[model samples]
Target chain A: MVTNEDAARLITAIKTSSTYDFTDYSDKSFCRRIEKILLDNNMDLNQLIHKIGKDKDFLEQMVKDITVNTTELFRNPEMWQTLRYHILPKFKKNRSIFIWHAGCSSGQEIYSMLILLNELGMFDQAKVFATDINTDMLEAAKAGQYKYRFNLGYLDNFDKVIKENPFNFEDKVDVPYEKYFDIDKVKDTIQMKPFLREKAVFRKHDLVKDGNVFYSKFDLIFCRNVIIYFNNKLQSRVIDMFNSSLNRDGYLILGSHESILGASANNFERSKGFYKKKQM
Target chain B: MNDYKAIMIGGSAGSFQVVSRIIAALPANYPLPILMCLHRLKHIRSGFVEALSIKSKLPIIEPHDKEPLKAGRIYLAPANYHMYIELGNRFSLSTEDVVNHSRPSIDLSFFSASYNFKKKLVGIILSGANKDGALGLKSVTDNGGLTIVQDPKECQVPTMTTASMNATKVDYVFSTKQIIDFLLKLA
Candidate 1:
């Protein structure tokens, strides 16, 4: 029911009421989050305009609500399998491989990559730069403890990836998946291996505002699922940022369902699930 | 279901055949966006969409995060995530935790659609082993949306349909063939 005029008005109201500027964020997802807040609070648009001015807590909650910091370990195992067999091994040839897991939700993908690298016996040479805009999620990622059960299917994907004959080298290295986790008997959840947790460094950075991450080009950058919460313009901008951020021939892994369509498709050469920035 | 913007139908175990039946009946230019969530294996991604599209006339898409919801198309909730509707008629997916042990959860999508679409939602719950969509169908009714539950007698698994009937007063109860016929009228 919201029109462009209403969205512009809401943006004005939010900017006037709070210090944060949401004008650059995707309007579609932004409106949805606002609508959710309206529904949860049982308030209409007019009431929302008034409440944001009068109530500070509502403004704070709205920021947290809009930032989607939800992800699972190996969320899409096929993507991770690509990382395991195809991507990570390519990076292994380098003495010290650097990775940036932009918008790493709860460090699931980070840990997944680390475990894969560990299995390949190259984890010691890799450093994972995992960061998020949300501090709460960043802390969770740093903690590297998960309450959810590590699904057996996640392990199954690892096995399938090992069997895929990675790098076409003909020799496949096998590792037991259970060794990566230390069972928490009381909580009934799994905490990732301590050795892997030490390798991932978590930080807080907004993908929209942060111009450069770490000021060093990375061998591989994972910006999966993160770009989908954006409009075409923002998506293109982020993809360009990622393209520049990667070293030549470096890979960019997106979500399984996400593709670099339209203008963004030109930034990288597609190889099925993998997108490699062209060597200039 | 007057002036309906979207049609949401969700199901679980034993629901594939029912979903295929509905899709086979929908024409190429069905007016409203049809979103579906069927419980599936978490790791298997590619085959399901291809399987669903085999007999469907409408172009079936597994929505990327924040993809705009469009008319005359069908959207499937992808694996290992719960798809939600934003007020502006776009899709948002979250992977907080699996609900009712099912990602791409039926209830999560239904409840969100109920809130977003409100009076414009047509919610349907079909054959399944669990009670995932029961409360969601209730939410559809609460928000003045239409609710349909497959007849338990005709369901491959009746736990979900029976639970849905027990949860709230639904607007319609029909067999698979009758459900297809009803959807045909809307198309």
Candidate 2:
């Protein structure tokens, strides 16, 4: 039950004590995350603040815990469907397709993208880059292992996006899960196949502070379900960064419900299910 | 009552028609922003806002993430997301795991609104089958905000109201008509 004042105190402590800056995060959700942290650790605000000030390792863990890492393969099948059928086909002309998954939580999205790209026969030409503020998440993204039973539901989503053609329902492809992942029911693990795992270059990058790490512009940027944690000011700043990082006529695919707003909205034109960078 | 910044309503199950009636009674120029976190089918995203807007004078919207909160508008929690009202009076949507088996969780919404608005908030619990809003309404009470529940006898499903009454010392337990009349007085 951390109050707003208490959350402010913790934020200030983190800012002064570490390089991690949560100042511009959406306060309500951030505060709720802090509350959850305290409850999980069974510690009060004062003790948590003390730990944050003194222990660097503890602070890193806190940052990882605070950043919501919930994601799944083909989480929104409809968005993936649009990407598979409409968006990726446009990039067929490009010799190299550069895809960036900003905030690639637990790597499900990275695998989802790779699976789509591979199915389209564009895997060889695609350069995939993934970045997250949490190093633990980056490591998890690298490992590419998820709980089998926990993610069984998302397998249906994979089938929806990869197998079933919505435009032509009768035209279905029998794509086996073994092609992309090795599901071990005995071990309760769904390990992503090495080909899909190796495609993404996982890196530690902060969306709030870190500007475009890749000097080269991208064909598409996926920053799904990540910007929702940010306040309007921060969202605009990140959106502006995405605008500059994208190549002309490139796409910026946000989460299903996410939309670019404020001044940054001018840079993107809403395409089928994505925000396309307007040719300036 | 005029000093209240926003009104948060939490409902589930047999609460939609009651909510429709209540919002229909609010004026076009209603001074307070109404935040409704009704439990909805996670996949059906579009029609809820349209259905709610049919009889309401104010524009009903499923606010985009980080959209600024405004007066005279009805903000419904988007499907498959938890909506939070931030300290700076802006909407923040989250796709975190669902709470109480609901994505647009009533408890989570009320928790944020209560924290953000503090004593200047008004929280009302309508007819529901679940106990999600009980803890949230209690949060409003704990934060010194006004708390109301639809009179359980008048509710289609009394579990939510009954749970809310047990959760905290609610300020009022009003019937649908009384609740609407009370909100009208605020305007």
Candidate 3:
């Protein structure tokens, strides 16, 4: 059992040795992650304290483990379909649309949005801001490459999205996923096309920290599946940031599972599971 | 048993119908809060709570993080997130990598609730294909909580029950009918 003092010392050591401050994260989950790190290394708290400064990769790896959860391409396809059909089409006529993919871990959501934009013929009009706190994830996102093989469910979702593509049924605008990716047999990865890579700027930013949002106003913000670890107070702070970051009537898309009921969010309107910032 | 504040039940494939039936058996005002962690598909949003609620006497909820766990309610692990109880009866969620090949692993919830609720919980293992709930049941027993397993013969998939039995000494083994009776008696 890890004592509060042990957790405190660990937090202090981590903050002193690194740029990440997880003080605002939920205490139990944070402490559990510390325990996991210790268990993974077969080291006691004192050894972990010693390792904080000596091992250059240790703290980085620990933060990465705690923060980077599984993300998928075209995750929760119906939500994407809603965005494609109802929300994003309005942005087609706007001049220079700015979109932020907050906590865009491994860049799947970023690429997914880009794919939609290209299909909608709005790719060139969009300037994408993709950010994550994990340096390693941001580096991977910068490369714009992913595994050639995707989850079968992902393919299933793609198929459903196309079959359910009610907006362009007559036009038959297709999602040519293969066109954006080519197989690298030796590397076992798919290289995202160079053209799509040019549209987005990647950065490392913490969601909990103020002034870390890339732009003051966004036409749309996609911050999905990133806030579950946060306690209610932190969640409210992040939502407030999202509410402020969005432009008038701009969309804030959360994960399918996230419920927005707890937050005041009085300035946001629900439009097909996506929240729109009201012009208050 | 009146002092027991919470009940935790876990399972994977083929557990849903059983879970619903058990919920149907319990009263609307069942005194103990029920915490359940069942393996579910990650890609799609589930209507699991609503589906289970159709037959349940009590309200079924997909609890959010830091929410207080209330008695006479059923709290389910949301799709793709592991569920844990913070030390003070507030729920916490984690997106940590799936354990035992399942997010919302039975073991994760059982361990946490056992650590906190201690002898005040009744941890149960039901129908599942994987061995996810076995170690969790062990944790409950270690914490002096009562343990129950659905008998393998009655399970749609017996692997989970057999695994639980192999992991620790389960207090009672009941078929679906017997389990329903047990819940009714508790009510």
Candidate 4:
């Protein structure tokens, strides 16, 4: 059993020696991830800490694994509805738009935004910067490929949640199974369309180290469903970064269950799923 | 009225039918709050709340962050998030790693209520494939709260109910109809 003191020491050592910071994340969740990492690497707690103390690659892999990048497209339909109805109207006055999708795992959400923008007829005018620490996921996102099983379900959900007309049968949509995928009958490989491939740029960026990317102010930022892994302090710091990154009156969207209320409540106003930067 | 403050229901696998039946049986004026944690796939769209709401006599909604826990209403767990009650009539949501491979794990909510409500909590464990609610029911019983389990013979999936039976002497081992009657008697 790794004591809290041991975890705290490891966190302190990593912050001073390396760029990653795990000190402020939820203790229970962070400890659980660490336990899993130790089990996967077949290391006892002491050995794992010692290995992390010396090995840079091992440390990087551990940070990436423990980051908790799991998210689904439009995980909460109501939040997206809130964004469409309440938040998007504010952006109508802007001539151009910038969006930063941090921790954009597998790019389903980036594509979801692209589709939303397309529906809003703003896709051509928007520039989206999508980044994640996982290079493999970024590559997959860039390739615009996903398993067929996920696509079937996503298509069903997209039609219901986004299209909002369950009566319009999915078969009526010209989503030529081919348009969305390149299917291999024998090998069972399916490649998805690189949705908004031209308008979006994919990059590998760590939120902990590359904290300065927010220098270019954006009109909207969607960092949904990613912060549950961070400790309270890191959550506060990242919310600060998000606050700073937005231009005046810009919107920040978060996971439905997440709230900046307790930690960063004063910085933004709650509107549906968004926290709008208080006018300076 | 007895201090029947809040009720927590736990189920897995064949829970949808049981949940629907319970909600349908409740009167519109049912005065206590009800919270449910049902195990389902993380990715699939859930119509559990909607389906139940249509059949239910009381108001039903998903719990929002810091949303006050009000009486005369039912709140179902949103898919893929853990829902727990806070100290003072509020809800807390967390994407904390899964326990027993379930995010809206029954154990988390039951344990939280057991600690917070003591005898004021009423726990019911229904149909499930695994023993997710055994420890949770135990927690409720040990904490002086009331515990109920679906009769194994009546359950579509008996593993979870059987586990609860083997682990502790649950207050009630009733069928879905009998469970509704039991709740009505308490109400």
The lDDT leader among the candidates is 2
Model 3 chain A weakest 10-residue run by lDDT: A256-265
Residue-by-residue lDDT tens digits, candidate 3, B39-123: 8877545677778889988888888767788989999998877888987798877777778999877898998899889998899
What lDDT is reached at residue B18 by model 1? 87
User: Clashes in model 3: which pairs?
Assistant: none
- In terms of docking quality, how is candidate 1 classified? acceptable
Report DockQ per prediction, comma-separated: 0.28, 0.71, 0.56, 0.23
Instruction: Kindly report which residue pairs in candidate 4 clash with one another.
Output: A24-A231, A25-A230, A25-A231, A26-A231
Sort order, lDDT high to low: 2, 3, 1, 4
- Runs off by more than 4 Å, candidate 4: A1-17, A77-94, A133-136, A161-190, A203-214, A231-234, A266-269, B1-8, B13-35, B40-47, B50-61, B64-75, B84-103, B107-123, B135-148, B165-187
Candidate 4: CAPRI quality band? incorrect
Per-model TM-score of chain B: 0.97, 0.97, 0.96, 0.95
- Compare the candidates by TM-score and give the number of the best one: 2
Pick out the ten consecutive residues of candidate 1 chain A with the lowest summed lDDT. A148-157
Candidate 4: what lDDT?
0.76
The residue-level lDDT of candidate 4 at A114 comes to: 77
Candidate 4: residue A280 lDDT (0-100): 58
Docking class of 3: medium
Q: Give the candidate order by descending DockQ.
A: 2, 3, 1, 4
